[model samples]
Target: MAQLQTAVSMIYPPRCTTCGDLVESDFGLCGPCWRETAFLGGAICDACGVPLTSGGKDGVFHCDTCMQDPPPWVQGRAAVIYRGNGRKLVLALKHGDRQELARPAGVWMANMVRNLVSKDTLVVPVPLHWSRLLRRRYNQSALLGAEVAKNLGVSFCPDALLRRVRTPSLEGLSHEARMVALEKAITPHPKRGHRLDGKPILLVDDVMTSGATLKACTNACFDAGSGPVRILTLARAVKEA
Candidate 1:
């Protein structure tokens, strides 16, 4: 299949996800777009994975935001800093029906958190409300989580988390309101036999903004017997300093 994809790419070169420029590989951005994407690296929050300007003491760093109010998950990692092109690629995947970008996004996500994955790990995705799922015709996180699990050779449970409640859109809500709205929105899949059973879980998502949604999802996983939940998103929104 990879060979076939290569052949197809040779015939019809794959274009960038954010821009139409021809890139060397599939589901990627051109050099300029790549540069424009602020890939997160270097020192970051030990809990939430926000890049830090100054190196921390004793090799343990927690951003001020996380220090004040930590996330429910054990740790987190994001592939790109959500701003210009990162935002574009994420929007393309979320609302533009560019499902093809999931492969590369998953690849980047897998690479970002390969150390967190193991044979016993359970890869799950943040659930979408049925209404939104029906309207979107796909769950981008499920696509990303499946590909990530395949790349890491771990168990992928697309329905591990279920969005039982369909709430209003989270956009434009205050942080506190967003937190309240996301409460009880996501819960573990009620399938009787499938339990996390102390297994580590990698929660996948397309993007993380205030992380309220991911927090709700993480709490659900913990309540379902999942252990040491870690997060990985394609992009994370950060305001300018």
Candidate 2:
């Protein structure tokens, strides 16, 4: 049966989830499309995990924004920079319902966090408002979080956090406006059943844009007795304001 399915799929090859081009490989992305993504390189910014250029003087590596007001999360890691094919891939997984992309994306993120986090860590996804979830059919962050937890052998808590507000689309907003929009957008689940008390948490999200969303979610996690919060994402948009 498996071989027959493979033969049928080969006859009608599915398009690459990222580029929408005919996929030649079973892995879902065309070779050229896959080769275009540049995963985070060495010496990344500790705050947001954007790749850093070599410094001349002090041997320090810091993105310009991280040098200013630092982010609230203890550590952040991203599988790739959000540009070119990377951005397209993330959008497909998120809005296009090509969720199969989550498997590899989540594994890549989990491997990045394996040494940094432990098996005991709990996985929490940045929550989406109910209205948004209803429109989207599924929460991409939750799907990614589930895969990451499965790969890391950690507990996955999908409802550990909840969103309190349904903010407008964040595109074209200033950094301050984005922060304000996310402020108080997240809160702890009221059921009190999924206890995060004294447990470390790894927050999963599809992309790390301005990080306002992650910061708000992490603050709520800390308030609910979760330990230091670390973040992992499929992509990290360059911080250019």
Candidate 3:
């Protein structure tokens, strides 16, 4: 097996996940692309994981938007801020059919929320409507969530939540509009909902923009009797100042 693996690597050297540049490792970014990626650090919003300009002496801090409209989930963390190479990674995994990216992306997300995972934590992903799932052939969120669960050594419930309604793309919608469109669109899966009972949940997603979809998923987890729920995303979309 070791000899076969070496032959494969020799035939096809590993390339950067984002830019297709030759890299020394598999499922990783090259140095230049890695430098350009906006990995999150410092103080971030407790509700949504957006990096804040100030750390706030109190040790706890939230961005103005999260303070005004709190997220449905208890806490949130993201591996990267949505921009530059970070955005490229998200778009590639989500739309460019780069399913293998989930491995590294999930590892990043798991590291971000490592402190939140418990022995009984269950990893769940935002669900896609049947039509969308059929069209896309796979749910990006589920791929990331499963990988996170594997890295964390926790149970993964990919279908714990189900998208009941087929909603339109919310790309250009306002926050309120997105919420309305997603209203009751997600529900706990009838057969799998039992897995969430009293379990701390680690909700995973590819990206968070308005967070309306995550809000719906969190509500479904609570409705299914899940314990404290936290969210993790590959990237957090932040507005420019």
Candidate 4:
């Protein structure tokens, strides 16, 4: 079985989905490419987990945006900041058919969720609309959700929330526009209320930009009777001027 797998790999030449370089091992990222990722560290927002630019006087760190209006999710954690190699990796995974890249990224996200979430929490991925899922061939958030659930010994529910409409890409939108767009895009699953009663939820996603998407999803989950939602993502984009 090992030899057959190796033979298949050699014929296929497994490559880093993020960088398109031949993978030196099964780890997905080449050594140097791995070093380029800027994982979030040190003081971070207690609500959204974006690295705080300055510490708060009360020792309670908060990003300026979070202080203005806390997101619907109770808290969030991200594996890395969305810049440099982290941005490239997420884009590749989402649009470049770099499905294999999800492995390492998912594993890292799973570890983070495991540490933060309680054992009984249910894991749910922020869902993609049917149109987007068809175009992408996979929901990156669901892929991460599955890995997180497996490693953490929690139940993974990919259908707990639904995207009711396909909105325009948020790439160039202002934060307010992104929030409005997401508000019109998502809704609760009909049956999720039955499944979510009294359950804490861990919401998984690929990357967080302004957190509008996650916040929308969290509201849907609450409508479906879920308890407080905590968000986990592979990357978080820094606030830009």
CA lDDT, every model vs. true structure: 0.86, 0.84, 0.90, 0.82
Model 1: which residue pairs collide? none
Off by over 4 Å in 3: 55-57
In candidate 1, stretches whose alpha carbon ends up further than 4 angstroms from where it belongs are: 1-7
lDDT by residue for model 3 (6-58), tens: 89999999999988999998998999998999999888888789998785657
Better of 2 and 3 by TM-score: 3
Estimate TM-scores for all models. 0.93, 0.87, 0.96, 0.87
Clashing pairs counted in every model: 0, 0, 0, 0
Give the winner by TM-score: 3
**85-115: candidate 2 lDDT, tens digit per residue:** 7888789888888888888788888988888
Give residue 55's lDDT in candidate 1 (0 to 100). Answer: 57
The global Cα lDDT (0 to 1) of model 4 is 0.82
**Clash number for model 3?**
0
User: Could you give the candidate ranking by lDDT, starting with the highest?
Assistant: 3, 1, 2, 4
Candidate with more favorable, higher TM-score: 3 or 4: 3
Q: Candidate 2 at 77: error in angstroms?
A: 0.6
